[model samples]
Target: MPTIHSGPVCRLFVLLARDAPLGVVFRQGPRQLTQLFLWHTNTDTFEPGDRFVGNLSPERGDLSPDGKLLIYVAANYTMGHHNKGLPPRWTALSKPPYLTPLALWPNDEPYYLGGLFAARGSIEINLAPYALEDWREHKPSFPAGAPPEGLVFEYENLPWTPSNQLFTRLMRSGWSQVPTRQQSETVDIAFVKAHPTKPLSLVLGMGSGNSHTYTVHHEAGNAKTKLVGAVWADWDQRGRLVYSLDGKLFTAELDFPGKLQPSEIADFTTTARRRPPTPESASQW
Candidate 1:
């Protein structure tokens, strides 16, 4: 484990982008710094490489399996403990904490979340998706203070129902005076995708449309397989998949017409992986 108390080190979480070969990493910090690393899966070795995100406080991040697009969630400051009269949850919103996300290519010029705030030593969270060149932001169906936490998605075990309803099981406190409550919420996002096998059948709704379900039919013979529910990491290429019930990462191979061949692979026993760090990168701070 890396030292957390040493001067002010942060935790860097790495995830693959929606469409790239290289991985993206986000590190937590009081100030931003650039640290890039390459992981040799075979040898379990980490090597230093180029500086990815310039010294930015990588608060949270999620990787798409295909390793293309890296979604990073960064904030100006963490929500600290204050306001004894109010519940802990109220601190999450006590101040309008600005969160700025930087979407970048590993070996290229990063699209910095620029503006006056960025110039003033403060990070900016532009909720405006239109400003993002290559990304499109979808409106969330659930209400504020709903079951899901975090800036975008900060919860686990989010399930989609048969009726196309999205459900989230979250443990929340400060919402009420009765300590944190284990809660759930459901909502519907109108979205659809063609079944991998049954071209005519539509797989409607998954992960606020970030995920979906489909069917696959073997062309050589007569066998129909239904993809119960699958989350997309990197389109049809090398992507990460999970069983809806067990939530395990399975290696996926997609055939031309949406047919999928998955192996019960356990690359890691955890849902998230801590990316290796680059030793030679400069500090963005």
Candidate 2:
């Protein structure tokens, strides 16, 4: 077990192995802009990596299964009030019409990436066929003479194979409202992490307003299992579940055949309480 440090970590993932490499989205200095870092547990230090000047936090990115590829949403920095020392202004990272994939390798260079939008926090890549889900808008449905009743948006889970064929849709969401009502009963699923070996099982973080929960659901089946009530949830390659709630980290053993039992592995609640409000925290509306 690694010692929990006292600082702002937007997101983190550790490979399941002896001396596993740790991937983290760490908040930098007083500005609190997030950047990716590779942590070496043996030396207890972080390796220098790429930096995103904008409001790019850990919640907007994820690491590939092998921890070699990084996919993230690139948000532009917005200038704060002149009275207060702030950052520069820029536009959103995602463009209109379609979602693009922004990828980075070990050399800290950009590569031609493809998928859906990088803004979604819940994105996962699987082995064998190699597929990922992209959330974007689809065609609008109109009732014959009706003027476009509502626009349909879907998280099209696309798969790529060896054949020279177009990407196939693996999973699709039901038609949701245009603007998405705040009080809507629809539970938005995000922060998706697929099982290391099981292609059919997926662990997802579901959020509805202030309440959140983590659940395990089958991709081709309907058996949904609630794992824990948490704001964020992730699984390591070894089938162990790690999650954070109220700023504390907990680990659960899920190799068994039944219900999950999580234990408090590390506590950063005190560190979180002592920190000042970040720009991301203040911008919540």
What TM-score does candidate 2 reach?
0.39
lDDT of 1 by residue, 1-285 (tens): 011133433343343322334443332343454443433223333344333222342222223333322334222222442232211110011010111112221211123221111111222222233323333322222212342222232212212231211111000100111111211122133233232333332222332544443333344354444554332222221323322213323444555555667765332223233434422212110
Q: Count the backbone clashes (under 3 Å) in each candidate.
A: 22, 2
| Candidate 2 C-alpha lDDT tens digits along 1-285 | 234445534333232222144434243333444333454433434444444445443332334333433434343434443234321321111211111222211111112112222223343221122111121221212212222233122224423231111111112111112222322245554334466676434444334553555666555445555644355555543455666554445666543343456687554333222222232311111
> lDDT, candidate 1, residue 113?
22
Which parts of model 2 are misplaced by more than 4 Å? Answer: 1-21, 25-54, 62-185, 188-202, 205-212, 217-228, 255-258, 270-285
Best by TM-score: 2
Q: Positional deviation of 156 in candidate 2, in angstroms? A: 18
Full-model lDDT for every candidate: 0.29, 0.35
Candidate 1 TM-score, true structure as reference: 0.31
CA deviation > 4 Å runs, candidate 1: 1-19, 22-71, 74-125, 128-204, 207-224, 229-234, 238-247, 252-261, 270-285
